[model samples]
Target: MTQDSRQSVYERITATIAAAIEAGAGDFRMPWHTDGTMSAHPVNITTGKPYRGINTIALWAAAQGAGYGSAIWGTYRQWAACGAQVRRGEKAALVVFWKIDEREEDAGDMDDGQSDPRRRVLARGYPVFNAAQVEGYTPPPLPALPASARIAHAERFFAALGVTVREGGTRACYIPARDEIRLPPFAAFRDPIAYYATLAHEATHWTGHPDRCARELKGRFGSESYAAEELVAELGAAYLCADLGLACEPRPDHAAYVASWLTVLRNDARAIFTAAAQAQRAADWMHARQPFAA
Candidate 1:
């Protein structure tokens, strides 16, 4: 594709996510709640691979809006190939991928005249329908484990990070300077998932320490940068929760941030994109540190 095609796709995907975040700012809900149809990570039906980066945000928003409970998604042809038919009236969700093209002739600085690892990655999208939008398809059954059963996994997962977490505090926060997270006792929370959800939020924040991910952290209080970082932490936690099969309800404490997030989105159409990108970076950082357990 040409430059115009790449720009066209980038603009479309950014606008879709920005609109979703803006709409989510209204109610402080991004549709990752337990009450929603799909509580697990959004995945491709054909590939069974989880969607990552901004695509996760896009698909979750679409699934929440459409009340799609199934994780299965695929292109129209894919549905037919699987012996299923997309409902005639069912609209498909927009999913994107990067199309890379390498140019060996353009390697001007290479002494050996070899093609560098560099390649132009273009943003492109396709329309995919959820299994709920199809007929004659039965997704294999997977049970949603109870919060009690998931507690052990959540504990081991975060414990593997080895981040300093202190309980007994009413307010939950990550002190970047000290590099520690404070939270109320897990028992004080309504359930185990909420406890872990809040911890995941702070854990994401911890990943932003200068010694760690070293993200842009010097934002004025109440400034757009600060709001953007908070957006990243919250969304990162949501992504982490999805990874661990925990419920990702928007905390009531985050309600105060809606107006701030909305202000940032209103001023810059791409703010949500940046937030989603950083959020993915944060989630990936922690994911890399997660230890595999039998």
Candidate 2:
């Protein structure tokens, strides 16, 4: 791929997500939010691994737009390798990967006779088709855990993070000064999913503390930095929920942030890419705390 390939990948993914956000703006829905059909995170059917970073968001947006019930996806050849064929005329979605370009260069001011090796990582786009667009293959069945078990699992997950979370508040937020998370009692939420989802959001914020991911969360209200942080937390929560096999729902209070997010994306084509990468880091940080984390 050429230099233009990198910009096109970012622009294409950004435009897809921006369009999904705009389509859902009226209902306060986000591209990341999962309806029950999309209960699972986007995964590569061949690799059986969840997509990460911008790929996850980009595929989710594609699934949401196309009403794909399955979260599994793969390259056209991958599907064929799995004994499935993409249906006629089915279009593919874009995902990106970084390719390293390594070269030996003159080492300036170095006594070593050997030239130093220089490496440049470039973003390259790959097209993948959803399982829903294929025939003769099936995604593995999702486990059906009881509600109590699911909540217990979430509790254990949060406890493992070791973040100081204080229950009993009218709103949920991460207090950067205190380096703690605050949320209303679990009973305050409409359901277990809502409670855990809210916790995930705040936990993402907690990951951004100066000692952690170091995102700028102390910016003035309505500032671009503040809004970007919110966007990161939102995407982080969605990613975490998907990984945990929970359906993420859009928070009603966060509707106001959508306009700001759109503004950010419109102002900078790479905004979504940066936000998704930051969100992935936040989610990975939380996952690393899990006892069974790979």
Candidate 3:
């Protein structure tokens, strides 16, 4: 297929998969295992093995499901290959090529019913490149923050989120055991305005603690829940940035979780609104906490 056509196909397939996930479609399982009429070629490390039948193919798909962060669905390269010859009434088996990372071997290479489970070796391999290379997909640059912002502005942002910032020698910002917020020395604060921006972001997260707003902050770093929190913080920062007429400095750390965010957003249309509200509340809480200059 032409590159453009292949890309179109990939987009369609990925969209379908994303929609299915959003609609509550659980992990993909081997159809043969569900039915009872398919098998795979025996693994021969010496000669390598070709994926055979729908069950084996589905198993590979299941393995792909375990990918995390931006690595999910690692580089799929599909090509139509010759089918196995069959008897007069038998259906032909199409060969589906899968070039995945060696790390996925354990999940992808499990035998249906003829091997010791302990024999599985989780060896890892790096792929130079298989497919995920699309042109013109550059991410927009992160926004920049200006210098010369007052410490009071930072305090105000914290107060709006219902947190108070304590002055300390250190230049870092953190919530104090879910009670009060503490910020590092303003002098120590790097890029004063951005430092507060970062503080606002973290303060928003602090609100989610059980002792605070009690937002569920329980998910693996790359899972949907974590991504949701990140989205909240980003929105919160954006809101505060707009209020202060500051540039919205993008959180570079968030790039790692972008795929998961995409997944969550695709799954729930309402999630964006909920996260945004919580973010705004957090921003407001911070703004309320700033000490007013007399």
Candidate 3 regions exceeding 4 Å error are 1-152, 155-190, 210-212, 217-223, 287-294
Question: Can you write out model 3's per-residue Cα lDDT over 4-112, one digit (the tens) per residue?
Answer: 6434433433343344333332322211111100111212112234232222222223333432111112221211111111123322121123223333432222211
Across residues 180-288, which tens digit of lDDT does each residue of candidate 2 receive? 8889997898998888988999999888877776765333223588888899899889888876656689788999998999999988777787778778878878888
Candidate 3 weakest lDDT stretch, 10 residues? 30-39
Name model 1 segments beyond 4 Å from true: 1-11, 18-27, 34-39, 102-118, 217-223
Q: What is the Cα-based TM-score of model 1?
A: 0.85
How many steric overlaps does candidate 1 have? 0
Best by TM-score: 2
Q: How many clashing pairs in candidate 3?
A: 23
lDDT for 178 in candidate 2 is 88
lDDT of 1 by residue, 39-116 (tens): 467877777777876677777778777777877788999999999999889987776665545322201111111214
A best-first ranking of the candidates according to their lDDT comes to 2, 1, 3
> Which lDDT value does model 3 have at 130?
12
Clashing pairs in model 1, backbone N/Cα/C closer than 3 A:
none
48: Cα error in model 2, Å: 0.6
